[model samples]
Target chain A: MLAIVVLLVIWWVAYWLKLQPPHLLPSPLDVWGTFTKLLTNGAVWEAVTKSLQRAFLGFAISVVLGTLLGLALAQFTLFRRAFGPLITGLQILPSIAWVPAAILWFSISTEAMLFVVILGATPSIANGLASGIAQMPSIYPRVGKMLGATGFDAIRFVILPAALPGYIAGLRQGWAFAWRSLMAAELIAYAPALGIGLGQVLQQGRELVDMPMVMTAIILILFVGILVELCIFAPLERYVLKQRGLAGAKR
Target chain B: MSESTIVPDSSPRAVAERSGLHVPESLIDAATAVSINRVSKSFGNDLNPDGSLRAPVLKEISLDVRQGEFVCLLGASGCGKSTLLNLIAGLDSPTQGTIETPGGRTALMFQESALFPWLTAGDNIKLALRLADVPKAEWNDEIERLLELVHLGGQGSKRIHELSGGMRQRVALARALAQRSKILLMDEPFAALDAITRDVLHEELSRIWQEQDLTIIFVTHNVREAVRLGQRVMLMSSRPGTFVRQWDVDVTGERRIEAPEIAALASEITTDLRREIRRHAK
Candidate 1:
């Protein structure tokens, strides 16, 4: 509610200041009108579904490989010594930076877009899992062993649950990376057969000087990211925290 | 709080009578639950340039705990009492000696409850039961029985955070029991509780120890707590900890922390413990 009020205030302030023409910086009312128009057109829905498909597929691949890599890095000293620094270095490399290499490797294809998303997301997920395992309380393992949870059983029952918070944090970061990388790929790849995605829609709006269409695409992109975070990850994280008695309602 | 027999009869006559036709295979298995001989432990970084070993935490510590004996290891803070207990618990190995526990498995209880916060009270015990190899079919009944043993029969479903400190420790005790081990090692399990709660748990521990026929090696810095619970108290010296003294408190019935005999024994031990500390000052 407060966020909506803040957005309204920013919009009114920009209009009052006369900072830019309506064609470049569309008014809040104009953006809203565009939103309604796109909602009825069916084209916006197609782009949204396609963007979501790409993001989900790339994020899924990143999670599997990243979790495996993170576990190995955390558990084995040799593996950590060899690749830990390099993995952390990868996290700071921008998702946009991968577009050029991905285009060269896969040649303006969906596979190229996927390559960029996975590359962008995997390090953050892996780092999250590794740090989570590293931060586990020593007492957890002691109690686990005393109770006869050994090796794989210990990892499954004790280590994994203990590391859930960190892993979830990693997942959140990975999703952000995948989303950004997907948009960057779609904007740059220019594959005619890839169909309409939000990134492509925004790029086409730029080419045609359709400011309302660009603004609509931007709003949808932001809305989708925030929606998934609130609807999926937030609830999942809250449930885990609540189960551990770590989450409490404010007094 | 039914006033059942909280003390076991260790009398020769009782032993002779029990050694008759009713001798079970478990009874004939081992006379001692834990045997530690000349045990010493040291910790230091091996990569240190000087290559000199750090002073041993515990040294030349030899002790034997008979089956069903409640023994307390009493010492000052740095006496390595905890190190000795860990060695006996098999959490760590002794640097210079051997620890033998012929008694199948041992369960250890820490000062903190250490219950998994994610689990309900009942689920905590169930995890222990699972690890102890209790069959899945028997878990419900076994969980109920163990909760009842800790006097927490119907409170199993409560989350760990909802329980009071005393109740949490009781749940910890129940989890330990679910291990179904021959020996229970308690590392000052009640040291953190308030006086009233500690007194109550002392009684609870005494009753449970007798009923379960468990051999317990309890480590503590509190003299009264040691005297209140143990059949025998062994004092350890600090700095390369070694057994300095042992006292057998010959109380036959349930013992209280405030009992005259307990206070007297505690004072004597305290005097010896202070002297050991003074020796370290020089």
Candidate 2:
């Protein structure tokens, strides 16, 4: 709430000071009006649902592949030695790098967008999970062994649960990357077959020189990101922390 | 809590004696719970710049613990007493010779309690029971009985974080009991607790030991703690830890940590422990 107010104040001050012309950077009130206009017209909902569907699909696939990759990296010395550095390198590489190659491979369709999203998100999730497992308290696995949880059972009930906070961290970072990658993909691949997304709308706004629409699109993107974080990842992170009594809530 | 009410049914162990981490075609005679035969454990592969081998943590240690024995293996810090207990628990293997717990998979307790923070005290015990292959239907009642055994009755619903250090250890004790193992290994389980809590746990442990008929090999650096709990105390030398001395406390009734007998025995053990430390100082 404080962040929203501060951001609004910053935008209002900037508008009052004429940081940029009205066509370039419009007033917060102007952007708000554009936002309401878009909302009432219902075009924003189509873009939102389209982008969200693609994001979720890409993220879900990334989660599976990333987790498997992460576990293999954490578990096998050969896998870690072979691919660990490569995964770290991929994490540093931006989503933009993948767009041209993805577009060439899949021709500006859902496949291209998904390919970019997966490439962008998977490395961070895998790395986060791998690192978390690596730093897991040594005592937990030993305790599990003593209690007769061997092999897969140990991984499922003991090791994975112990490494949960790390896995959750991976999921959180992975989602952010997925969202950013999706937007980048949408912005670049403005093909008719790609339909419309928030990023495509923002690109259209820029082409038409509509600053209010651009601001509105930007805020919508930010709003979706914040909403997902609060609605999904926040509860998950909170649940894990609460399990360990680290959530700081009064017992 | 009355001691008489905490009597455990022997039927559980009798019925499940065959269920363990690994089934054996033959077990060592029932008289001995554990037999460590010339066991030596050394960290492998790692070497000094001089290309010399590191001294084994446990150097040719041999011992036999009878059924229902509460044996304390006492030593100073870095004496590898925990390494020995770890060997007995079958978490690690001896580099040379053999350590066998024929009775089955041994339950272990550590100074930190080792309770999963994600689980409530009861659920922790349930996890142990489930892993031990105890029937699912019996979990709730067994959890109640085990918590009651540790004098933490009705506290099973509490989260591990909700419990104090001493209470957490009690919950750990209850969880250990849930494993239904014939042997229990403790490595400085109470070393992290306050003196008063430690003393109280000692008494509780003694009562539970007799009631459960468990063979416990408790390792600790504290001389007074060793004398306070164990029926037979074995003192290990420093560094490459090997048992050097043993004494049996002949007292039958309640033993106080500060009693004259306890103090006398503690001082004598401290002397042996100090002599081992002095060798390092030299």
Say which candidate scores most in lDDT: 1
Measured over all alpha carbons after superposition, the RMSD of each candidate to the real structure, in angstroms, is 6.2, 8.0
Two-chain DockQ for model 2: 0.71
- Residue by residue across B225-272, what tens digits does model 2's lDDT show? 888888778778766777776666656676987688889988977887
Model 2 residue A193 CA deviation in Å: 3.5
True contacts kept of each: 0.53, 0.75
> Cα lDDT of all candidates, in order?
0.85, 0.84
lDDT by residue (tens digit), candidate 1, B127-190 = 9999888999999999999889888999999999899999999999999999999799998898
TM-score of each: 0.89, 0.88
| TM-score of the B chain in each candidate versus the native B chain | 0.86, 0.85
Per-candidate DockQ values are: 0.68, 0.71
The runs of at least 3 residues in candidate 1 whose Cα sits more than 4 Å from the true structure, single-residue gaps closed, are A1-22, B1-30, B45-54
Chain A alone, TM-score per model: 0.93, 0.93
Worst 10 residues of 1 chain B by lDDT: B1-10
lDDT of 1 at B2: 17
Evaluated with DockQ, which candidate comes out highest? 2
